[model samples]
Target: MSTAVTAGASGAPRRVPATVHRRRWAILGVLIFALLVVVLDNSILNVAMKTIASPAPIGLGASQSDLEWAINSYTLVFAGLLFTSGLLGDRLGRKKVLLAGMVVFGGGSLLSAVAGSPGQLITFRAVMGLGGALVMPATLAIIMNVFERDEQPKAIGVWAGAVGLAIAIGPITGGLLLQHFWWGSVFLVNLPIVLVALVGMVLLIPDSRDPNPGRLDPVGVLLSVIGLVLLIYGIIKGGQLADFTDPAAWGTVAGGLAVLAAFVLYERRAEHPALDVTWFRNPRFSASVAVIGLVFFALMGVTFFGAFYLQSVRGYSALKAGALLLPLAVAQMAFAPRARLVVDRYGVRATCAGGMALVALAFLGYLTLDTTTPIWVLEVIGFVMGTGMAHVMPPVTVTIMSALPREKAGSGSAINNTFRQVGGSLGVAVLGAMLSAAYRNGMSDHLSAVPPALRGPAGESIEATLGVARQLGPRGAALVDPAKESFVHAMHIVAGTSAGVILLGAVVALVLFPGRLPVPDAVGAQPEAEPEAAPAETA
Candidate 1:
C-alpha cells in the first residue's frame, strides 16, 4: 500500500498509489504522538528543577547558574544540530532516522532518570537534546512527505495542536509527579511514551526518501553547527557571564554570524549543500521560520519565568502554579486546531502576523504585572497570549512544510525548529540572568537596613532575596516577611523585560513576513530532501 511519486505534467512531484492518501490521516497521528513526546520533555522538567537542585537528589550543590544550564544544555545541542539532523533524515530515510531518534531519546531519558549528580543529569540531557534534534524535524518532514498539498494545512494544524497540548499539560503533569515522587520521575515519564512511539513507528510508519538526493556538504554542516552554538551561547551569556559590551560576548556573536554567513556562501557554491540558502530568497520560507522563532522565544520566556514568578515570588506552591496555568493551555487547545481553517480562508500572512501582534499585546499586559497584581489580570494575559500562539503556529508550520520539495522537508523542519530551540534557550538564560542581577542588587540594598547581628544564615535556599528573609527568622524576618517590597520590584523588572522581548518579536514578524504568501507553484517544486520539525513555535 506504499506510494510512488513522480513529477507531474507541470514538473512538480505528486504522490502515486492513491491509496496512500487514505492512510495519511493515520500516519499523521503517529507523527503527532512522536511530536508530543518531544514537546512535553522540553518543559516538563521545570516543575522539578528546584528538587533537582537539592543536595539529597543530586548532591551537586547546584546554583542559579547551574539551574539555567540544566535547562539550556539540552536546548543548546538541540538547536545547534537540528538543521544537520534534518538533512541527514532527508538524505537517508525518514522512518529509519525517526525511529533511531526515538530510541536515542528514550535512552537519554533513562540515563537522566538515574543520574546521581547535576553534571550527570546535564550530560544526559544533552544526549536527549541530540535525540530531540532528530525527532522534531523528522515528525514534520514525515507529515509533509505523507500528506497531499491540500490536506497538509489541516494535518499541520493537528500537529500544532498536539504540540500545544504537550506544552500546556507538561507543567501540571510535572508538578503532580514532583509533588508525589522524586525529581527523577520527570525524566522517567518520557520512557513509556517513547516505547509506545517506538513500537507504533516501527509497525505503522513508512519509509520515504528524496528522489534526487544531493551529496552531503560536510563544510556546510560544520559551519552551521558551530555558528549556531556560538550565537546561542553569546545570547544566553550576554547579560550574565558578561554584558553585551564585553568583547568576548560581542565577539562570539559577531563570529557566529560570520560563520553563518560563510556557511551560506559555501552552500550556494557546493554541488550538494546541506541547506539550500536559496530558501531564504523566498520570503515565504524565511518569514515562516523567523516568526516561529520569535513566538517560541516569547512563549518559552513567559512559561519558564511565569512559573518561577508564581511559585517563588508569589509564594504559591508548585502544584498551585501548575493549576493556575491550566487555563492558558486550555486556550491554546481550543484555538490551535481551528487555525488551519482560519489560515486556509485568510492566508498565512494574516494568521501569523495577527498572532504575533496578539502576543505583543499580551506582553504589554505582562509589562504591568506585579506581586500584588490581580490573578484575573494574569489569566487574561495568558489567555490572549495562548490565542495568539494558536493563530500563528499552524499556518507557519503548513507554509514552511508545504513550500519545500518532498526531499528537503527534513532540513526545512530542522532549521525552523533549531531556531526555536535556540530562541527558547536564549530566552531563559537571558531573562534568568536579568532576574538574578535585579534580585541581588535589590537584596543587597534592602538588607542594608537590617541589623548586622541578624544577617546570619537561617538555613534556607540562597538563590535570591528570599534567601535573606529565610535566614533572618521571625524577629529578623520582619523586614521582609510581610512584604519584600524590593524583591517584588525585581520580579516585576524581570516580567517587564520579558514583555519587551515579546513585543520585539512582533516587530520582527511584521517586518520579515510578506503581506501574503505566494501561490504554491511560483516557488520551484523540484522533489528535494526534507528536514525535521524542530521549529520553536511548533513545540
Candidate 2:
C-alpha cells in the first residue's frame, strides 16, 4: 500500500504518490477509535458511579458530589488546558503530542481502575484530564491539517457523530460491564483500546506542526488553569450559600472571581498567550462561543440531573436509564449531518437561533413533568432537545475554527471547549443544588416523625437514609417513599429553571448570530488580520 508517513517527531518522510497515501485512512480509523475510548470514558463513568462506589477495594461510597467530580474534574482540566494544548501541538508535533497524551490517559485509567479510595480516584481523574487536554485538540488539529476545508464540516460532523455514538452507547456499555464485573472494569476497558491506538499511531499517523510556532506562555497556562478551577469551585459552592453571608462558601466565590479576572489581564499581556483574547472583539466569534457554551451547559445539566432522577427517584435501574437516554443520542446523531446543510443554506444566525428556540420549547415541555410523567413524553422532549443541540454545536465549531488562522486552530478548539466546560460545570452545580434544596425543603413535612433535629439533616441526605431503609425491608422502605416524592417535586422546580435559562439563551442567539454563515474566501481559511506579533510580556 502507498503511504505518506513521518518517521519521527521532527523529520519529514520521503514523498509518496497520492495513490499510495490513500490507504493511510487506517490511521484515521485508529484515531477515531481512540477518540471513542476517551469520549466513552466520560459518560460511562457517570452511569457506573454508584456501582463503582459500592463495596469494593475502592471503599468509596459514591455520593452525588463524588459522581459530579468523577465527570467534572476530567472535563474541568481538559477544558482549562484546551487553548494551551493546541499551541503545544503546534510547537511539539501532532504525533508526538498524541502519543504522550495516550500514555498519560492510559496510565490514568490504570490508576483509576485500582484506586482504593474516592480521593485516589479524584487524583487519578485529574491525571486523565491532563492527558485528555492533549489528545482531543491534537486529534482535531491533525484532521484539519489532513483534509481540505471543503471536507472539514463533513469530516468533523462524522467525528462528532462518533462522539455522539460514544455518548449513546457508554451507559449501555457501562451497564453491561458493571453487570459482568466490578466498577473498576469500566476503567480497565481502556487499556486494550489505547494499546491498539498507540500501535496504530506509529504505523499510520504522521508527525506535523505549525511552520511558525511562537514561544510558550507558562504564566498564561497557570492562570487559565487556576482561573477555571476557582470559577467552577465558586459556582458549585453557590448552591450551598445560606444568604450569601457564609464566608466559607462565599470566600470560594470571591477568590475564584479574582483568579479569573487576573487570568484575563495576564492573557492580554502575555507573549504567546494561551488564549487569544482578540477573538472576542469579533461579534461572531463571541456570540458563537457563548451559544456553544449555553447549549452544552443545558445539555450537561439534563444529563447529570436526569441520570440521578431516573435511578434515585423514577425507580429505573442503571440499565434502563441508559436505555432511556438512547433516543436523545439518536436524535443528536441523526440531526448533526443535516445541521451543516442547514448552516450552509440558512446561515449560522438563523440555524443557531432557531435551534435555541426549539431547545427552549423543549424546556417549556419539561415544565409539565411530574413523578408520573410517561416515558414517551420524556422521549419526545429528548428528541427535540437533542436535535436542537446537535444543530448548534457543529455549526458554531465550524464558524469559530474557520474564522481563525491555521496556527490558531488548536487554541481555538481549546477555548471553545473551555467555555463549554465552564457552562456545563455551572449547569450541574446550579441545577443540582436547586434540586437538592427544593427536595430538602419539600421533604421537611414528610420527615416530621424522624425527630425535629434529624429531620433537617435527613432531608439533605435522603439517599443515605434510603439505603438504610432498603436494608430494613418493606415498612422502612415505605416510610422513605414520601421523601422520595418530595425530592421528585424538587426536581420539577430544577427543570423549570433550566427551561428558563435555555429560553434566554435562545433569545440571545437569535439576536446575536448573523442571518447566515459567513462566506469566507475559502473554507477553513484564516481571516485577514495585521501581521503576526509576538505575545506581549506579562508582569
TM-score per model over all chains: 0.87, 0.87
Report the C-alpha lDDT of model 2 over 29-62, residue by residue, as the tens digit: 7778778888889888877777766665543786
Pick the TM-score winner: 1
lDDT of 1 by residue, 1-539 (tens): 22344444445555533444446787787787788888888668877777777787443466667777777788778888888888878778878889988999999999988887778888999999888888998898888877756566777777877877887678788888887878888999999999888888886677776757766678889999999988887776684563677877788888889999998889899988887788887767777777677667666765656775677657787777777776667777788878877776776676777787787788677666766788888889888888888888887887777667777788778877887777776666566666556655555544555566544322111234355565556744655542344445655675666666666656665676655555446244445333222122221
Assess candidate 2 and give its lDDT.
0.72
Q: Total clashes, candidate 2?
A: 8
What local lDDT score does residue 75 receive in model 2, on the 0 to 100 scale? 66
Report every candidate's CA lDDT: 0.73, 0.72
Error of 1 at 537 (Å): 38
